[model samples]
Target: MEHALFDDLVQSLKEARAIAHGQMPASRRIKVTAPDAKAVREQIGLSQSEFAQLMRVSVKTLQNWEQGRRHPTGPAAALLRIVQSAPDVVRKTLHA
Candidate 1:
């Protein structure tokens, strides 16, 4: 039993090393596009203030996103994508 455990550990270590050195390629990759805040707002038919309120961001931040002066990151970016894809769902969910 101990020998089998050691063998498994060694195999795991070897696989980890191979992955660390890029000898093994990852199995999958996901590509995500960032949402365009201005376009999303327009599509949803919301003004800047309304959109900013819905997004829970300041007006300045929304302006920056609209003008391409700055970009959203992390959860904000994810939420924007969701909002872009389904504005009604997002609106109902958020308002609820």
Candidate 2:
């Protein structure tokens, strides 16, 4: 078979293996640091929705983070800590 066709077949098999494990096809991830959702928003003069947009997360996720309906994990928790330290940095980075 042509090299291009062989490569495509290999890629397809990788995808099929991932689907068999019930995972979405993989890709890169973004890293974000956040602050206390409520405190960070208040500090930056934004509401939950605004903050969510700035952070590229959903409003519901922000609300859940604030209300303790859900917890921020991994990089999210780290972001919250970063925000707690310097909310201005968080704001700037949000738009950046």
Candidate 3:
């Protein structure tokens, strides 16, 4: 509704279009790859239910991540990385 805000929005849309068409490079880019949930679980020697419980997520959510229907983000992604690299630490910390 404000004039400045509207102008800024239009400028952003133009920038996005230019980026989409490769007319200009994006200002920033970030790439985050989701972990393989099933492999992490297998490496930890845990069942789906057990892994889900440890992750503090529902079994269906775990299944979604495992099946590639969805991705874990933010804290979940960080935890998955930890589980992959140092599963024993996770197990000890969580079981304690």
Candidate 4:
């Protein structure tokens, strides 16, 4: 029937679109979710200057992250979270 044929065509188009967009049927692209940078810094028991020193980034960068003026991306974002949960791990990784 024409209705059945149209349904098949629509399904095929959807499959093609999903493939073009690199979706795996139901998976979405990974978004890096970061915590409150200021809170993370505080938890590590460091002032802005001290934390920036430990992170090896400028204090302005830390301020931007905390204020959400910019978000950390890629390895920096990953390391920020690691620094939040396991500071020793960050220290070891950085020094290593």
Among all candidates shown, the one with the greatest lDDT: 3
Query: Candidate 4 clashing pairs?
Result: none
- Give the candidate order by descending lDDT: 3, 1, 4, 2
Candidate 3 residue lDDT tens string, 15-62 = 999999999999998655658989999988999999999999999999
Alpha carbon lDDT at 5, candidate 4: 98
Say which candidate scores most in TM-score: 1
**lDDT by residue for model 1 over 1-96, one digit each (tens)?**
699999999998898888889999756656566788899899989999999999999999999998999999878898999998888899999999
Worst 10 residues of 3 by lDDT: 29-38
- Candidate 3 regions exceeding 4 Å error are 1-32
lDDT of 4 at 36: 81
Higher-ranked by TM-score: 2 or 4: 4
Q: Where does candidate 2 have its weakest 10-residue lDDT segment?
A: 26-35
lDDT of 3 at 20: 100
TM-score of 4: 0.62
- Taking the tens digit of each residue's C-alpha lDDT, what string does model 4 give over 1-96? 699999999998898798788784644567677778899998878899988887888999989998989988877787788898899788778778
Residue pairs in collision within model 2: 33-79, 34-79, 34-80, 35-80
Q: Please give the lDDT score at residue 35 for candidate 4.
A: 78
List candidate 1 segments past 4 Å from native.
Answer: 1-31
Candidate 2 Cα RMSD after full superposition onto the native fold (Å): 6.3
